[model samples]
Target: MMKSLTHRRLAELADVYGGLFHLKMGQLHMVAVSTPEMARQVLQTQDNLFSNRPATVAISYLTYDRADMAFAHYGPFWRHMRKICVTKVFSRKRAESWASVREEIDSFMKNVDARIGSSINIGEMVLGLTRDITYRAAFGSISEEGREEFLKIMQEFSKLFGEFNVVDFMPWLGWISYQGGNLHKRLDRARGSLDVFIDKIIDDHLEKKRNKKNNEGFDGLEEDMVDELMEFYDENGGTSNLGSAVGITRDNIKALIMDVMFGGTETVASAIEWAMAELMKSWDDLNKLQQELADVVGLDRKVHESDLDKLTYLKCVVKETLRLHPPIPLLLHEAATDTVVDGFKIPKRARVMINSWAIGRDKNAWDEPNVFKPSRFLEGGAPDFKGSNFEFIPFGSGRRSCPGMQLGLYALELTVANLCHCFNWTLPDGMKPYELDMNDVFGLTAPRAVPLVAIPSRRLT
Candidate 1:
C-alpha cells in the first residue's frame, strides 16, 4: 500500500473485505473506513475521540510541532483557534470583504486572454492564481521575488508532507531515515525558509504598529491576516483567553498562517482544475453549465460572487467534480482513546483512514456511481457537502472538517463560473475530449496526473 496510491489500494482491499477493516503494519495499528455508516461512527458518533490527527514526521515538522489547527491535538487550544478562524479569518464577512479575490481573478483573466489562441496549462494557471490570492490575503503586500521563493518552499513542504518516512510507522527504524540526514535536512531547510520569510513579515507589522503609535498622522495600511493574528498575539500581554493554556507565540502565529496558506491555495486550485477537466470531457454538461452562466451572469460582464447563487448548474458541476475527485481522498485521523465502533474494537492511537473517494462512489449511495452527472445534485433531495450529508462530504464532516470551506468553495465556484462563462474551451493539438487524461497524481491532494492543457476562445464580446 505504501508503494502505490494508498487510498485506491485501501478501497480495493475494502472491496474484498468489507466497508471497515483493520491492518497491523509493524508497530502501527491501521483501520480503513469506507462506508458512510462507519464514517459517521468515527467522524460524528465518536468524533471527539477520533478528532485528533495522526501527524507523520513531516507533518509535525511542517506544522511546527502541531501548533497549527489542522494537525493540533484536539483540545481547548484547537477549539480557540477554530473559533478565530470561523469568526475572523474564514468568516463570510471576511470572504466578502476580500477585494483581492476579484483583483486576482481579473489578473488571471488578463493572463488567459494573452494566450487565448495557444495551448495553456490550466492547472498551473489556476495554481498560480490561487497562490497570489492567498498570499495577498494572508500578508497584504509582498515582493514578487519573496512570493516566488515562498511558493517554491511551499511546493517542497507539500511534497515532504506526503513523503514516506520509515520513522513514523516503525519508530525502531528511526535511524534509517536519519542515516544520511536527507529527510531531516529537507525538513529543516523548508521550515527555516518559512521562518525567514514570515519572521520578516511579523517584524514589519510590528514596526508599522509602532510607527502608528508614535506618529499622530501615521499612514495606516490595510490589515492582513498577520495583522489580524497580532491582535491575539499581543492580547493581555500575549495571554488572551483565546483558549490556550499559555500565551500565543511567534511559532503559533506562523503555524496558523501556514494553515491558512496550505488550506487555501492548492486545494482550491485542485478542485477548480478537476472541475474544468470534467467539464472539458463532457460537452453536454459543459454546454448546459455555460448556458446557465450565460442566462444568469450574461456575457457582457464577468460573473460576480453575487451572481453565484443564481448559477445553480455551475454549483452542480462543482458538486459532481468533487464527488469524482475529492481534493483529499484519504481523510487521516487517529483514535484518541480505545473504544468500540459499530460493534468493533478500536484501539487507542490507532490510525483511521476514511476513504472518502471510495465512499463517494459507493454503489449503494450513488446512482450510476461512475458517471459524472451534475444533475444528480440539481434534483431535489441531493446530499450537500456541508457535513450533514455523509455520502457527499467532499469536505469532511464534524469537528475536524475544513474550516476554510466557505472561502475555498467561493473561490472554486467563482473561478469556474468565470472560466466557463467568459470563454469556450477546447482540447489543444486537435485532441478529442475523450483523450483528455483525467487520471490524478495522489499526494497531499490528488491533482491531475497530467496537467490540463487546453485552448480558449472568447465566448463573449
Candidate 2:
C-alpha cells in the first residue's frame, strides 16, 4: 500500500482480481470492494453483517475508546448514539436552526470580496470558513485563544488519524514498531491536547447551565449541539433514553463534540476546495454554473440557502466534484459475522473497505468516467450522492452512511454558489485553466495537493 497510492493501487488490484478481492496484511484479512454491484452487496445487501468498525490506534484514542458514533461497533450503543445524532443534532430542523451559517457565509464573502482582483488561497479560506462555522455551531461562542488551540489540536489529530500506522496491521509487534515510529507517542500527544480543550469546553457548558443564563446558551434562536447534549444529560439523568444500562458521560460528550468538529470541518472544506479546483479547470462548466446562479440569484444580493435548490447547474457541479473526489474515498467497515459476497467467503472480523473513488470511476458504470462533466448528473435518471446509488455515492450507503449529509451538502453548495456568483475566478499570475494541478493529498479526507490560489474579480450580474 505504501509503494503506490492506496486508492489507485486498490483499484488496479481490483481490476486484475475482479471487483471484490481479499488480501492479507500481516494478521489482518482485508477485502476491497471497487464496483457498484459489489458495493451494493456489502453496503446494502449485507450491511448488518458488516456494520462494525475496525478500531485503529489513533481513532480509538481520539474517539474516547470508540464512544463516538462514527467508529463505534455495530450494536445497541451505536444505535443509541446514531439515534441521538440523527434526531437531536443533525436533524433537518437542527441543521436549519443554525442561522449562524448565513452569518458566517456573509463574513466569508466579505473577506473574499475585500481581496477582489488579487490572488487568494481559496482552499485556505474555505477551510477557515468551515472551521469557524463548525466551532461556533458546536461551542456557541469561543474565545480566540480557545479557537486557535482547538483548531491546531484538530488539525494535528486529523493528520494522525489518517496516517497508516503499522501497528494497526500487526498488533503484537506494536511495542517494537512504536520504538521506531513513535506513532503511539504522537497519538498520545494529540489525544492529550484534544482532551484538555474538550474537557474545558464541557466544563464551561456545565458551568453555564448551573448559572442559568438564558442569553448564554443559544447561538441565536436555537441551542448549539453542546447545549442540546447537556439538556439530554439532565433530562435523562446522564443516561440516554436507550436505558440506564448505557449512560452519557463527560467522555461521551467530548467524543461526540470531537466527531462534530472533525466531521463538520474537514469534509465540507475538502468538497468546496475540490469543487473550486475542478471548476477552475473546466471554464465552460464554471460559466454555465455562474449563469445559472445569475438567473436565480441576482448580483445585488448574495446567494441564500433558499436559492440553492433552484441553482440546478450548481448542484450538478457539486455532484460531479464529489463523484471525482469524495471527501472520504474509502468507506471502512469490519465484518461482524461470516458472510458470502458474490460467492466469496467473508469471515468475521475481516476488514472491509468500499473504494468509493474506484466505484465512481468504474468504466462500466459511467461514461468517460475520468472526465469532469457535471452534465452527466443533469441528465434524466441521473444518480446522486444520497447513498442510494452505489455508482455515485460520495457519501457511503446503508446504515453507516454519513449522518451529516444534508448539512454537508448545504455548506458545499452554498459556498461554491456564492463564490461563483459573486466573482469571476481565474488562475493566478495569468496561468491557464488547464495548467492547474489536480493532484490530491490523501488523508481521512483528500484535499488539493496545491492550494487553489486564484484571482477573483466581481462579476456583473
Best by lDDT: 1
TM for every model, in the order presented, reads 0.95, 0.94
For model 1, the local distance difference test gives 0.85
Query: What overall lDDT goes with each candidate model?
Result: 0.85, 0.83
What lDDT does model 2 reach? 0.83
- The residue pairs that clash in candidate 1, if any, are none
- Residue-wise lDDT of candidate 1 within 1-461, one digit each (tens)? 47433778888888898988999877889999998888988889889899999998888988888878899989887887788778777777774326778889989998998898899999999999999988888887633458888888888888888787778878888777454279899999999999999888888888877887898444646667777777777433243554554456788888888888888998899999999999999999999998888788778988887998888888899999999898789999999999999889999999999989999999999999989999999788999998988887778999999988878888889899999988999897789999988887777788889999999999887
The C-alpha stretches of model 2 lying farther than 4 A from their native spots are: 95-97, 142-145, 177-181, 213-222, 234-246
Off by over 4 Å in 1: 95-97, 142-145, 177-180, 215-220, 234-246
lDDT per residue for candidate 2 within 1-461, as digits (tens), equals: 55333777889998899999998887889999999999999999998898998878778988879978888898878888888888878888875336657778889999999998899999899999999888888877643459888888888887878778777778777668545368778878988887788778778777777655655643443457887777656323344445434557777787898888888898899899989988889889988988788789887878887898888888889889999998888889999988999999999899998899999999999999999999998799998788889998888989999998888788888888888888998887779988889987766787888999999998854
RMSD of each: 2.0, 2.5
Candidate 2 displacement at residue 60 in angstroms: 1.1
